[model samples]
Target: MEFFGMNKRKIIAIADPYSTGHHLSYNKLLVEAARRNDFKVVYISDRIGCKYINEIFPDTDIFINEIGISNSKISREVKKIVFYIRAFQYCRRRDIACLHIAYIDRSIFSIALANSAIKIDKLLITLHWNYFSSPENNSLINRLETKIFSWLSRGSVNTNVHSGLIVDDLYIHNIKSKYTPYPIAVLPSITSHEENKLSCDGEIDALVTLIRKADVSLLCFGGMRYDKGADLAVHLLESLPEYTHLFIVGKPEYFSKEYLNNLAMSLGVESRMHVYDQYIADDDIQSIFNACSIVCLPYRESFSGQSGPLTIAASLGKPILASNNRFIAFEINNQSIGEVFDSLSFHEVNRAFIKALEKSYSPKEFIEKHDPERFIESIGEMYKVNND
Candidate 1:
């Protein structure tokens, strides 16, 4: 249904505070798009200051504090104590309509606390996994937490009418979502920039220099976490000795530079591969996006349904060679957007990489397909009609 004869409502986003990074930069695109469509966007996070709080949310606000405290406390429980208290206080002060959770724990505690304190409507949550069953949240205490959380979610949904998950891939194991492993709807991240942007002199020099001096031709963007498939990509690239460069942007969750270097050296591609594990700020992003021709994410599972890099590539109109199993494959099912490779075999990936290298995409077509205009319109519809 098209929206007509109406005013855009205020839309607030409650994000999870996981240390800091532009990793959540996708949300910025959503906020911009929403505002352009006439909805007020209010973003909240405790990592940013009171200035940010004031800037993001002048009236009804939402925030959480999960950083600053060392994990070296008497118990892991101590850290959570602070997070819940801060989140609850923020909700109470703002008269929040909904709590948009970034993770399961954040949902469980914040919803539990919010429900305890006041009448919060539209309590929606996002899940980070497909119901396809992996080594995801099945710990004993986590199970108990999930059961309680699901109970709260059902209650909230009944009351509020507004809720979402980035992707809805529950029922993979026949387990209900009242707990940690349940599927949430998809709410993807985005990446955007000005139009008609061509490669700058310095960016051209950097890519040319890499091509001339080093053998790097590929880029794996994002944290080198275990599930993120960094080592797997490394292994696959090791087999493709002809493909000289696999430039990894971002730091590793566990392995250090020395360890990754050793892996490259052992694979005999150390001379060709490069690792820029330093922090890449928001201002440097446009150049970074322009530097690479393709963005590769070969994960064993989907990001529940969020893909910051994938969405960025789609927006920037760069080809993406990703794993077929992820939820994004359903949306980005074409060569220009990039194709999926086998997560199991190096041979499968080698062929996929060859095809991906042969292909490129048009920015115009990508923006038309995945532009935030339609989504913001849809979200605006939901915002106005969800509670009514």
Candidate 2:
């Protein structure tokens, strides 16, 4: 059913304190999706995210800390602590129909603390992953965090997760979750298929400069964490054809540029790679996507959340070369968008890379079953379930 006469109902989206530039894109999409469904969104985020969102979504209601501090772990946490106190106050003064927390782990303590002070009709938490199978994920700190978040979730109307596997995992732990697919972050402006083609001579020099030089531009976007397989992408370059160039984009989280370069040099493929070890600007995101023949996501099993890069790639109609993680595998097979390799086997990775390079195509359709509209509708259903 269409959402109508619900414009006054408040849906607040509290962003993750540690959200990076890449994540803000999807966060904006979330706000837009909610507004499109006739609900007014009260977007609460860090100063950086607020600025970015203001530029993209000026009409939405927004609130951020006044200090406007720099992006750092301590600063973000401090800002969020302040934001949460203010948020609870705002909710207390007004009847908020629902509260949606992004990066829910970061705000669990705040929510738990506020629960005794105030109550709301519906509470929704986005659990990126609950990797109960991984021993590393069961450390004392992680365990404590999980218990707190799980306990808070027990009171929530619905816990949102990216894949059914995650829902099943949460089920084993007795916390029910809803499978909400990650939304398409970037919507192509051009509807005609012919207009979407990337011209080799486009004026986007930063991207074109590299795309024009290589036969295949293999893009690895987002944080350069070891779990993200940046090194694996570099390792593939050691034996890849000289025509293929690996572009590892995003800020270095764990892997340093000097280390990556040295490894590439030792493998004798340093000349065929470009490592932009900084946060990519928003406009440059599409440039990088346009310049590449295909997107690569060799993420390790350690990563259990949805792949934002995969969503972005699908949005731009670019093919993906992903690992065999259940979510990635399901998306690749479900949409016929790309090929999946055995993440553990370099041999399979190489084969998938070759296949991706040999053919470039887009998915037949978006994962409509889990698209944003349906996601909002699901949340609406949950709201009704709780309010009834």
Candidate 3:
């Protein structure tokens, strides 16, 4: 697995908080990139995430550790302090040349603390959101955290973000960052042991059948949250043509399938709506996306990060109908991939969805520009141990 003549410096470690959702695919892509760049990677995540990584790359070394904090204010602060102490110690003991944190939103302050004390050769962080978007985010405590994070970035620490808008925002604050493409979640060619569990799940076939029966099926894929606007998707169904259907795939975070169904029932579109409230396997992603006419993303204004479902939809050549979030709108408009509308306006979204259905999209050019190899190479450059 070693690349000949590749710089054999100290190992590069990647730390991620969560194991589920886009984390699994993102971590896999990162590990592959590190290996390709000739860096020995020590993957660190929770026990479940570690096991999943092991199953994917059995030969690669991995470390099982909890990297996320609790939700409670007091408990979260306490856990962050402990995590910072332990992280610094682990890097010192392992002689880690570079420590790249995959997601630093929740643990930014703790990571800032660790950066000050850790003696690693280099540190890398992926800034996923624009924290300075609101006055609340600029509160005294948050400003302090941002200052520390930016100060550290000028040293051995390198920072990157998936959105160009985030990069620009960081630049405005005198923080330099690289714009890395969000890695496409390539479904595995060979089904994994976990995916095999869903082989006999009748829900997959039922959903596919339901979508195929419709004239035009709208899909809201990936983890469901109130911010993601599943309620808006339901509302759109009521105004669309009678033949239009909606399929919601992925696990719900703060709501239940019954709640969404009830909303659809209230809108009198219950007969045309379908819900699959569970984690979908890699094998099923293609079939599900293929069944849908358009991918809907009506995320609220509070959501400032890139959408995993948007990436998936674009890669699959499925046209998107996304909210006018800075990143999502940029991608759709820049690439001519689909249509965009303000998430707050029900009438706008309704009109935009119909327009998307009628318009033809040629995402092949967009797909070619942001392929997985390009994303991997960008990350590999960031993971370079000898950046001097």
Candidate 4:
């Protein structure tokens, strides 16, 4: 591809469907790395994602496209098939050297079906979850997808996973894979005045104020889903001291605000629980984390994968109270960052919660291990090696 008067042959195309949550920061990191390595990027995402990228890096030679996929499950699947077909066509037309799929779960079937029809120099997939880690995922459909994905991995496609445990699992299956530390966005430290100024019209400020009122607050950030053990977080509040509060942030996916509040009220811990059932912007993240004493990740046993919040908490030097997921438990124990609990057992969670509050943590080692520059360099090297 030619930009201005210069021809840049190393072109990487990154495609992610959703723009919210970690995608915004993760995509921005990839774009930054691509720019630093002199590789032109074609970022494909939903309309909001395209706008977000254009606004952040206005001067960079990056091409952004809107992948028109609706929110409905069936509609999204059909649209994804069409989108991948068109995306590959665009890649070929532009002579894009590499196509990296940021999330591979939803598009596995589409890509497998389109594998023979489309051609690209290099294809990379980031596996966010280790589907093969659990026997519960032995459903027929999952098995079929696993077979297809394994076939794809055995070919020209290279898989990128955040967990070393996942890499070992893939190795046993004879799939080519590499481990890259999950990129954590470096959020600027905001003082009380700056935080109040950056709040979403006083909403976040009010939440922060309420959380700070507690002597020690536990924050459960991100989507409130069943697998994430949102209910367990509320339950744990019953066992802790009254002054030890719990803050639930992020949009509620499986449980509503009223449901959680009613649950808390029924358990007699309503006074100590704060729930912000809305999406929190990136600028406001550090302020919320700062307001709380610890970050809680009560994910269930089925979720044997890495967590964005875990890394976020580590970066800010906040102690964590997380479930014993394979990757999360390993990170906490290996880095000496925080405590792990049995998510299914209330007694264990409460015990671990108290211990985590009392324990002094030093996240200097964790921060150094997951430095953003190291992640960026690894990703850049992956693309450079593939291109060569």
Candidate 5:
């Protein structure tokens, strides 16, 4: 008969499911993948409820909730702690085998609350940040994180990292993880309906058609802010006449409107640049990709985290000219990914912009190389093999 027969895994995916962003999409993929292998799955998110614990109670042999968390106010923290404690009680009610918390804030506190609920043999925490690498980070946060990891080691939550660079740094810092120094998986962000909305009429259509036809040489995305390379985007666009339009999307700049208008006037590319100071809906994001000849993210060096937005552009197979910092640059080098450029100097950004306009890369090949199936399969099994 079968030596290793099918196993049952119960996974509780906890994240800020408020938007159709990376975290939520990852959960969906996990559950679906589990189903393919005859494994029971449950997705839990807080994006929908105020329930100290609300549960989706999946149709499978598992349970999940899209959990929302609160760390904003004093009362909110107290209420959240109490709510999380109640969540442990709820997990007990349904027999949650392994809980995977997505965001840092959610994971840290959730682990604290689920202390008694977790069995050392089954506990895991995925490391999504390099607390040591942060520029102005307070020592207190790092200290506490270190202490938390030490505590988590008994159960030893696997720190699934996406890069070998992070793995080495964590080890150098004496932090612990369970998988390869690199993250175990790389699930590129997907636009829920990014394609459908791109084809819609009105403002979105006009902008897309105009930009695509004109085929602008340089386009900078992310918010039009200094940190996100707003000024650099403008500076580079002005430096190169071939670089036509810079599609400035995401949250508005410091002001409502005039900052961008003024920035354009200052750069003298006001007429060439088009700014949409609004949140690009998940379904409508493809327009951002389709409208630009190349996507650029000139992020300043910091220990913030991975660039989900930049990664999104890369996955779609567009030519992405990105900051040449450690995380972004390493991603390009290790994965054979995109066009990595020096973000510190405007001259470098200008040169990279020009190069991107003339280049095209295999988006499909990038995905093939990253190969999300292993990542997806393991997560799926994580839920299926655990006994509730």
Candidate 6:
């Protein structure tokens, strides 16, 4: 816990257990940067996150255990309470100068830690998605949780918000938090395991086959949700030329095959539509990006955060056609990295589609400005400013 008699500038990234490969990639970039900056980097995460960190960074110090948390409604509350207690005790055991957590949502652990009696020099919590900004997230339970969280967040100096829009929303609700956009991490290379293609046997084969057969592909990646514009994507794909195919990947939640098939059948474009309702492999990320002519992100207006898919698309230099959501619109204006559609109008969407085909933008400048090292350094500067 201490180097010699003095406590080192120890930083621990409290990586969330239930997160995407994107988070793992971000963590690897972060800690590596921290290590280069002469800080002892520690990672505290659940079993899955720990295994991934080990595989990625073999010699990193990681504290891993079962958080016993589930998304299931039956025992979510009980599990979260238990996890919070354990997380508190775990942090108390370590001599952490700064505790950095990313992608905070409904979790109360960050707020609790920041306000706890533990003598942490600083606790930084990065919020990925902002629930209060999403119009559709107005259920009684969600509202109640937001109200409670926002109330507690006002008194905490640890929270880092990713969107200017979310920051404004939080301010209106009296929850003061810092606005810090997510940094663009480096794209992962094709690993030996990935290059082997041993796991390409079943579903992936079918996916690759479908993608290969298409003359032009429009990728609607990420999980299917109402906010993600799955229905709109299906409809747009239906309206496209016969040679164009829509590759709808990722597990379906609010969107379903039955609904999409029925829509496709009705639109008489079922033959041109190929849907793989499963999670895509991390190694095949470049393949997916390459296979598609355009990456579509027609998310609803309610989305108010830095989009990982958008960042990845930019990182890979893929052309993007995204709806004019708050953050996406801001990025489009700031970087000219993508074309935006008027999400309110179908006619405008069709025009945007045509525009994307003829348009291109370089992500080179954007990518350079937010590279991992540059980004982590900015965070270090901010931490210094806050501590000072």
Better structure of 5 and 6 per TM-score? 6
Please provide, for model 4 over 309-334, each residue's C-alpha lDDT reduced to its tens digit, 9 standing for 90 to 100: 88778877788998787677888898
TM-score of 4: 0.90
Instruction: Please provide, for model 1 over 1-388, each residue's C-alpha lDDT reduced to its tens digit, 9 standing for 90 to 100.
Output: 1123433224444455553565244344435444554554445555553234445536423344544556564444455555655654564455545455444433455456655665456554545433223235466755655555456656544221111232132333333433322211122322345532444467444744563454436677776766667766677676564745777777666555677788888977777667766655445555666567567787656244456667567677677777775455654575257877756476877777777767767666655545555555544444444434
lDDT string for model 2 (113-156, tens) is 66546666666667676554233467675666666666676654
Error of 4 at 278 (Å): 0.6
Candidate 1, position 204, lDDT: 41
lDDT of 3 by residue, 1-388 (tens): 3334534254677887578776777778889888887667777778888888888878666777774657778788677666666766676676666777888876776777776676677778887766643233567866776677677677666777777767666666676544453544334432121323355358788888788888888999887887788877887776677888888889988768999999888889999888889988766776777778999987766666677777667766778988886667887898887899875465887788878988887646755665677778778877763343
User: lDDT per prediction?
Assistant: 0.53, 0.66, 0.73, 0.76, 0.56, 0.67
What's the CA RMSD of model 6 in angstroms? 3.8
* lDDT (10s digit) by residue, model 5, range 1-388: 1112333133453433334334544555555665566544443445332132223324543223333445465655565555455545554445554555444443465466566554433444555666543433448866676567556644446555555666666566565546543333334334232365234547666766667876464556554454566665666576555547776766665434577668889867887776767656545566657667777676666534566666667677677777766777777666655677764465766677667766766666555544567667666555444434
- The reply for model 4, stretches above 4 Å from the true place, is 1-8, 59-71, 132-136, 177-200, 343-347
When summed lDDT is taken over every stretch of 10 residues in candidate 4, the lowest stretch is 185-194
lDDT of 3: 0.73
TM-score to true structure, per model: 0.72, 0.80, 0.86, 0.90, 0.76, 0.84
**Better candidate number, 1 or 3, judged by TM-score:** 3
Question: Could you give candidate 6's per-residue lDDT for residues 209-253 as a string of tens digits?
Answer: 678778877888888878788777777765466788888888788
Backbone clash numbers for all candidates listed: 16, 0, 0, 0, 26, 0
Whose lDDT is greatest here?
Answer: 4
- lDDT, model 5: 0.56
| lDDT: the better of candidates 3 and 4 | 4
Model 6 C-alpha lDDT versus the unseen true structure: 0.67
lDDT minimum window of 10 residues, candidate 5: 1-10
